[model samples]
Target: MAPQTWLITGSSSGLGTAIAETVLRAGHKVIATARNPIKAAQENPQIEELGGQWLKLDVTSPDTTKTVKDAICQAGGSIDVVVNNAAYSLIGSIEDMTESEIETQFSTNVFGPVRVLKGVLPFMRAQKSGTVVNISSIAGLDGLPSCAMYAGSKFAVEGMSESLSKELKSFGIRVILVEPGLFRTKFFSTFVEPAAGLNQDYIGTPLGDTLQHFKDLDGKQNGDPIKAAQRILEVVTCTGLGVGTEDMLRLPLGPDCFDRFQTKCDALQENLTMMKKIAYSTSY
Candidate 1:
């Protein structure tokens, strides 16, 4: 297979760095982006050593579209794969979350990818081939207490990816959603924090428990970020486990994520079966 160029966001740590390393090792060119290039270099010191290019990209910034386009132009004017992986989880009860917090969550997690897509899709369309990988989470498949806002943002990504998959199918572009379960990464070590001010009314509820659960699971997560990155690379490159899955849409990593996906599908099936008559009546 010919070496392809990959552009990944949030490449400072966690899955982003893992993917960057994996792609570089496979002899592909990688353009890794982070909000702070200096800090990203500090976190993933091997990025430059591995021949991956680092660029400053803040998904929340209005200038992201231009930045991505410029980076692509600099990298020989062609991009084969794009991984939208920059996102932070905002854990808090819906009542405890302020409007500004909600907006920030969506702006970063939801609209961030939108900006990258705007910057790259036109080039992909002109070339008539490209893969778009959106890094989502298990929270996207099923909403959890204390993670409503984060889940809402992910759910929006899920919906948008589904729609984009259809819209771009004719153009030979594939859209994939990487829904991962808890993985050992800085995401838990540094990103997971409760709302600024906890609501006293909900202190003893599941919201509090969920927050504590994430803290306890920080360094103990069973999933491996490197392995996850490998699987993602294989899928994107159409090798190994991804050989026959060219049309597959969602790539759910980890047993935990698989089980959750099954549960959600089963519940949806049951609801459809039970509400078929009522739903049909409403149509008339």
Candidate 2:
């Protein structure tokens, strides 16, 4: 594949910034968007210095579609890859989270990317060639304690990406859902806490324990953002670097993600086997 232009969301820091830098290093053009373009550039001058354009974009805002479309036009009128990495972590139990909080979480994690997809689909369809990489999480594959809302949002991404991959295949567009484990990113620093009011009776259960564990592991995650970014780059380029197959639609990054994915698969298989008879009977 020739050098392609990439449009990445939330490129001010963490995996997004790493990805933007990696793409530039690979001699590709990049449009890195953040909520505050000026602050983003001040924080990561290498992005602009590497010939990548930085634009102010709020994925949750209704105006993002036009902003992205205009940016695409400015970037030579085509984007070969679109990486949706703009999302924040919302840590809370389903019962403790308010409707407003849950809606906000979904707005950023699910609807934001959906809007971007709708905004860019016309161009990608016109060109009949492009790749979409949705940044999901291991929690997307398995519902974990204390991360119900976050996981639910990612689950939406996973399902949408699966459907999109099929829908765009005939048009020569591909979709990759990158499920990553805990990485040393600003994600931890910016995690949204549960609502102000807490359930007193549920303070010391597994949910509480899980929340504590996450707090303790804040700055000590084992995954490296730069390496994860490089892997993502390979996947986007179809280069198979650190990937088992170039045609894979789902890429799980980090050892923790690999382990958790295997566990989830095994559990699913076991459940299916145990229910095979009942499932077959239902079909009849």
Candidate 3:
């Protein structure tokens, strides 16, 4: 296969760095973007050493979007892939979070990817080929307590990607969403913190324990970021888009994700069937 180009966001650490590394190791050119080029440079030295390019991108900035587009164009024209992976986690009860807090989270988690996609779409359409990989979470597919806000952000991405895949299908662009369970990444804890001034009055209950459990799982997560990166690279490089994607757009990568997704589907079906019994009684 011919060497491809990549535009990876949040390349300073965790999955973003791993994904960027995998592409570089595969002999591909990468345009890695991070909020802080200095920190990104320090953490991901291989990007410089391995011949990949790095740029400062706050993601939320309009100028950064234009710069990314310009970079992709200047560097050999078009990119083969664009990975939307720059996002933070917000862990708090819905009641504990302020309206502004949720808006801030959505701005980054949802609007950030939308901006990146808009920047890349023109080139992809002109070339008539490109792949977009969105890093959604398992919580997106199944509602989980204490993670409602984060899950809402991811679910919106998943929903948008589904429509976008079809919207760009005729233009020859493919959209793939990877829904991962808890991974031992920095965002699980230190990189993220409980919402400022959480409602401690509701502490010592199941909800509190549930929140703590998620935080505690940070270091103990079973999924490996490196392996996850490999999986994403493999899928995007597939010769053709997979089957039934229009109906079911995202892929659940982690075992926990898949099982939980399945359980949720089953429960939904059961409830629907039970509703049918009540609603169809006139037919008897």
User: Model 1: per-residue lDDT, tens digit, 111-185?
Assistant: 999999999999899999999999999999999888888999999999999999999999889998999998888
Candidate 2 lDDT, 1-284, residue by residue in tens: 57899999999999999999999999999999999999999999999999999988899899889988988998788989999999998896777778899899999999999888888988999999999999999989987888888999999999999999999998999899999999999777788987664566667988888877888888899999999999999887767683555567899999999999999999999999999999889753
Alpha-carbon TM-score of each model against the true structure: 0.97, 0.96, 0.91
Superposed model 3: Cα runs more than 4 Å off:
191-196, 239-248, 277-284
- Stretches of model 2 off by over 4 angstroms after superposition: 240-244
Candidate 3, 1-284: lDDT as tens digits: 89999999889998999999988998999999998889889877988898898878877786756887888878978888999999987776778788888887888889999889888999999999988899898877886767778889998998998889889999888888889886778876653434565588657866677777877777899889988888777777753343234334576777888889899899999999989968887783
> Where does the lowest 10-residue lDDT sum fall in candidate 1?
188-197
Task: Name every residue pair that clashes in candidate 2.
Answer: none
lDDT, candidate 3, equals 0.83
Question: Of the pair 1 and 2, which is ahead by lDDT?
Answer: 1
When 1 and 3 are scored with TM-score, the better candidate is 1
In Å, residue 122's CA in model 1 sits off its true spot by 1.0
Ranking 1 against 3 by lDDT, winner? 1
TM-score order of candidates, top first: 1, 2, 3
